[model samples]
Target: MKRSTTLISVTLIFASIFSAGSRGGDALGKDSAGSENPMRRFLIEDGDPNLSAIIKHIDNMYRSKSSTSRLKLIVTKPRNTRTLTMKTWTKGEEKVLVIIEAPPREKGTATLKIEKNLWNYLPRIDRTIRIPPSMMLASWMGSDFTNDDLVHEASFHKDYESSLVGPSEDPNGWLIELKAKPDIVGLWKKLEVIVSEDGRIPLVSRYYDRKGRLARTLYYSDVKDFDGHIIPSKLVLIPEDKKGHKTELIYEDIDFDVPVPDRTFSLSNLERKK
Candidate 1:
């Protein structure tokens, strides 16, 4: 089946912290780190040097300096299943475009994010809707995904206060938790990420509601090499309140730090028919 984009911003903002809590990928191996590394640049608490490095790598999964990818989104609810393929283009923290490529109904459907704002274009409606800041974290225009690709992109280092909550020997990975800091905007009150010391892949991530209830759980596996870097190509998210409801994102292709055009991030381009 065809895949989707981080564009799951057309798109999934993710699948961000509040993305992994964005569809995800494991970006680096234990030996390396990149400049756009989120954890390294914005670490709130410095406890374990090794833990901090690992945390940075996790954010890199979504906050890649600039990236392009073919993503496949499979949303499975107890009632039905919907699948879509999206092509996404992103440039650092500035811009992103996600276009639906299949299921003719959704083809040409897209979302654009520039700076911190979001817009959605519906081919059928022939309209461009500016996703309000208050609603950006709420839902996708056409799919069940709640994280906007833009919201997902800006999340991670930008939205939360991070700390190594504590080390868990039972889980065999450092437990990293994120809470919304003052002025930071997001839907989850808390998030927990588990990264295995044995590998570069994050084993699991849990997103919590404002009241501290477990809202959802994300599982990452199928670790594979994309280019020279090692990352997980598959991410599965299950919502706690919604029984049998899940979203799965698979990375069919991804290249980080590619060239991008700034104009593509504009509202004018978003509404222009392609």
Candidate 2:
């Protein structure tokens, strides 16, 4: 397949969806009211006090004031395998910029997401194309993930109602169930997440389609301590219906709560060479 075709088909996933906000520690973070961020009024809290805390913890895990990282994406198939290296910059939940670094042909290609808008820069043609809302669910870069996954348009706390599913022995963690709220539009109707018992790190998440069928599974591993924060450095995503197909995202380096200039997320910077 042509490099352009592959790049166009590839969709963003791990970085925006799972990367930013958690502060690793013993106590759960607080909400705006200066209280614990968990759903205290929910019945699930009565059954497992940690359930709500875990949900809130994981929801904010990858979030930070600002962050920067270099990642390696490996997409594997039955007949072919390809790799790409990229550097990413993010500011809070609003701005994100991803620039390809390796594979000479795609070296300068970039994607920018600011608030609700997303755009891609193709260096080869010196053109910028805006991604419409209609393509939010489209697969990115020929991968299993979607465009929405790239920009993180959905929030677990706001979009899904969660419940405690007890313990999981296989991964040795707590199982949490999340069902989509009827009002929100998303590809996954439900999700099952296994969170590590110790630090509440997400170990595995199973995505279920609208029909309640298992669609894909995301496995998080290789825990690393970045500064004071503990996070999974590697993530592997596999679709249930596809054989010998999977995408592995490995974090090469990351810095959280770092300084990021405003222009870094601008349209002009999208065309700037790395």
Candidate 3:
């Protein structure tokens, strides 16, 4: 019943994809001012097309201004179980670093940095490896998520060609599903996003595989207003094939626009830690 390292890695990679901020619906119809379509105005005024808003929505969740909760990752399967605690810090588009700590027998710590390049440091090996392109699809740390899932985070306005996918509903309000561009790289071929009509916060997303089959579903729950932005504090990921297998991520704390040390995301920093 033991899983291969590759399988474990894949699991972790996919898990991170679900757990991380990387992961999007649509509707049609008219405007209150009668000058243009109401829905279109809503989309523009809400800054849906603004890259800053989209990036801020995802990255600002881990800002350094205020103390935020540490991130805890629990990976479970029929045979293997692992838990990881991570502290993350970001500096503009130039740097991002995540320090990982795992307890018990593996007391080792590792640092991952994404700058102009990507690299990882292993305390045990005491070496830093520049991630190769071929390894992008490889599972991360014996989990289902791929390494690429972490490094190649997508932007809505740049990475996707979004359009209305019709109407949907959730606890947040009415929604519009958006489909990914056909040529976009990644596992998901399409996404169904539920945006709160009133709040303009994303509530839920349904991910479809390349085969056009429903592959996974992600729910963004527990909406909290932070710095004039409505953010989701809790996320749940459910697989289509695995009935009982589910992953949940709860943000312990979040901050925005705080100063992070410049060297915190350096590759040398990762190497020095090892």
RMSD of 2: 5.0
Write the residue-wise lDDT of candidate 2 on 1-274 in tens digits: 2343333333234335434344322244323122233433331344453665567666666566777888898989899998999888877666777788988988889877777677788899999888766566565445666555554546677789998787889898778899999988877899998877542578999999889999899999998866555678898989888889898889888887789998998888887753
Per-model TM against the reference: 0.73, 0.83, 0.67
Candidate number that wins on TM-score, 1 or 3: 1
Q: What's the CA error at residue 181 for candidate 1, in Å? A: 4.6
Which stretches of candidate 3 lie above 4 Å from their native place?
1-69, 79-81, 102-108, 138-149, 165-167, 170-172, 225-229
lDDT per residue (tens digit) for residues 1-274 in model 3: 0122322232232233222322210111001112245534544455344323332243323222322235665656656556656655654443555556546433345444454354556567677665555555553443334354444555455556555543455454444444567677877777766655542456777777778898777788787654333457677666676655555665555554455677766767766754
Off by over 4 Å in 1: 1-49, 137-172, 178-185, 271-273
lDDT of 1 by residue, 1-274 (tens): 0122224344535324213313333434322333344534333234443555555666665555556788887878788788888778876555677878877877998877666666677778788877666565555433334654335554445577787776667467678788877785556788898876542568898888778898778888787665544677788878777777777888888776566767777777767855
Q: What's the C-alpha lDDT at position 155 in model 1?
A: 47
Which portions of model 2 miss their true places by more than 4 Å?
1-15, 18-49, 139-141
Give the CA lDDT, 0 to 100, for residue 84 in model 3.
59
Top TM-score hit: 2
